[model samples]
Target: MTNRNIKAIKWFINTQLLGKWYNVAYATFKVTSKCNLKCTFCNPAYYSGTLEEGSTERLKKVIDNLRDSSVVVLSFEGGEPTTRPDILDLLGYAHDGSFYVMLTTNGYRLGDPSFLSKISERIDFLHYSIDEYHWNLKALDNLCKFREFGLKVNVQTVVTRYNINTLEDKVKKVRECGYKILLMPAVDYPDSKVKLEPDKEQFYQVLSYLKGKYGSTLNNSWGFIRALKGEFPKRLTSYAITIYPNGDLPYPDDINGEVIGNLSQNKLGELLNSYRAKELRRKMMENSARYEYLHLQTASFNSIKDLAEYAREMGKWAFTGKA
Candidate 1:
């Protein structure tokens, strides 16, 4: 088996078979918080360019820490990850490591052929954050174009109270292009007053309908769909963790919890096992009903069906470069 496959298998055995829920399987590294667009539903801190990005060397150290923690997947997110000057360097570094690297972008920088060409080889998947919120309605028109660069593209659409009905059309567009789309609800951050979160009943109904019609093209497990309806008890928070630009880990998650420690100062495995992390995990479990973050909620795969669905979607993407 390839090194990436071996790492994935090891992670699966550690987390799934051994029941080591704290062993992280995925890491979302926010490379920068300087986005070009001002989406109303997005967290201001994420796009305000206020967070100080660490130097490339420091970020590499953070990646090394995640690798040591046995994280199987590392997704580079941001205000806009492409906004960073050394993004290619970081992506290439992570790609060379054991983690399967992915980049999430708004596609603004992707218009530059040179930049697109450079990033395509350094990452396994390109998660395109497209929606009316990003002001990229016509972005779906160019989905197939990235295939020419040999980049596997996945659409990530924000399902808000205003845009829930339009999701079926987006799924259709993605399916036509032989791509998959992961739809998530717009979260109301503690710092923001705007309530863009969709109604639970309506959101679940719409997602269920889309999943039934579109199959793997929808890219959401039934468990995740059920979790959207306030069924939040089975959350797997530690399965995926988020890291800030300067290497701070928002233990459990950024939305409902506090920073446990800085990855730059401590190893990820050690930090996750610290007292603060344990206390926060207990608190998060006690108040799980109120948590609505998509990343954390989706990690709560309560049934075998969920795991099977995820495996099938990932298998197709890994082998065929399509989903």
Candidate 2:
């Protein structure tokens, strides 16, 4: 079996059998908060509260901690991860570790053959951000080119009132490129004057239409899509985790922006066992039944294939926009 499969199996075992819900299965490490483009919807383009880039040594230690726990996938993100001179070094380190390494980029630097040559082999997949705000529709044409390098590609589109009506065209482009797209609602930071978040009913209608017409190409699980519309309960602590550029762990992630502790200084395992972490986990368990994806009835997994089957079923429901 592949290392990725082994790690995923182990993570599933830990979370289901041992009750390690706080032990993250997926993590987004903001390598740096600095980005090259000034996208109107993204925070990195304007937010200045990010800490200085952590040294390569510091990030490696963080990766070690996550791998030793139950993290299966480690996604490297940034204002633009390609901007960092040591990004290849970081990707190489994670690739050598137990976790499957993925990179999220704006695709600005990916057009260069030499640049793609150096980093393509180090990552398992590329999460290309494409939308109207980024104004990089040209990148969509280059999706198949990255696949030629033997790398999986997934597009992340941030949905907003401005772009909701036009998503069908973008979905067609993704289908023509032979890639999957993960659609997400745009967040309106409390401090921002512009409110691009779509209307509640409109958001549901758009998501449902995309799911029904192009479910095969959409990447988000059905539970997640429904949870966004308040149809399903969201258990943030039960699933993914995000580590900020400064090594700080934010509760419910960036929404509240409350830092629990720095991973650079404290062990994540120990922190999760602490009072605050325990309280959050306790809350997660109490409300776990509300999350459809959990399938609390039979939490045990016989094999990785079983888990995949379950996810596939949930994904079908998500595509149908079924409650």
Candidate 3:
């Protein structure tokens, strides 16, 4: 079996059969918070360049920590990950590690052919963030250009109340380019005054319709589609975890969970098994219905059917390079 397949099987056994729910299936590593765009819907601390970035060596240490943990997929995120000077080195290091590496970016730096060429081989998947809020709608017109770099591009668009009607156009464009697009609802951060969360029912209807028309081209699984309407079966805190720029884990997640420990300072296995982490997980479970982290919500598999569907989708994308 492939190394990736082994990791996936181990994660499934640990989290599913063994009842070790905290075993993570995915890890979003916030490499840096230095982003060029100032999307109002985004949190400033993550994108305003306010958070100090770790050195290449320090970042590698955290990657090592995750390698020892049950993380199957390691996604590099940012204010904009490209903003970091040593991003290529970090990507290469993570790419060589055990996890399936993915890079999430705003497509700002991807305009450079040199940059794309360097990173294309380093990451297993490229998550291009584009939407009306980013003011880079024109980037969608050139989705085909990325295919030359030999990178599987997945366009991630934020669905909002204002732009819900325009989703079909974006999906149609993505379909024409033979690429997949992941649609996530616009979440209202705790500190943000502007409420951008879409009407739940309308959101579900639009996603369901798109899923029916496009199938796997629209990366929302049946379980995740139901989650759009707030029908989550249980909290998926252990399914995925988000790491800060400084290697600090925001416990179960970044949304409602607290920082239990730093991966750089301590091993991820130890921290996750700590009393503080256990207590926080219990506390978050009491209010599971209120968490708004779309990624975490999607990762929270509602049923075996949903989990199987998602696994098949990811397997195809990872092995065959098709959505």
What is the TM-score of each predicted model, taking all chains together?
0.95, 0.83, 0.95
Model 1 steric clash total = 0
lDDT of each: 0.83, 0.69, 0.82
lDDT of 3: 0.82
| Ten contiguous residues minimizing lDDT sum, candidate 3 | 293-302
- For model 2, where is the 10-residue window of minimal lDDT? 292-301
Estimate the lDDT of model 2: 0.69
Q: List the residue pairs that clash in candidate 1.
A: none
Clashing residue pairs for model 2: 34-79, 35-79, 222-318
Candidate 1 ranges beyond 4 A from true positions: 231-237, 292-298
Per-residue error (Å), model 3, residue 250:
1.1
Tens digit per residue, CA lDDT, model 3, 1-323: 75666888887887777878777678899999888988868888887777767888889999988887788889999889998889999999888648888999998888789989999979999999989999999999988888898888899998888999999999999987778899888878878878888888998999899999999899777777776677765645547778999888897777777888888879988888889989988887777666555444445553667788887887887778767
Candidate 1 lDDT, tens digit per residue, 98-212? 8789999998988999999999989998999999999997989768898899988889999899998889889988887888898988887767778898998998899889888
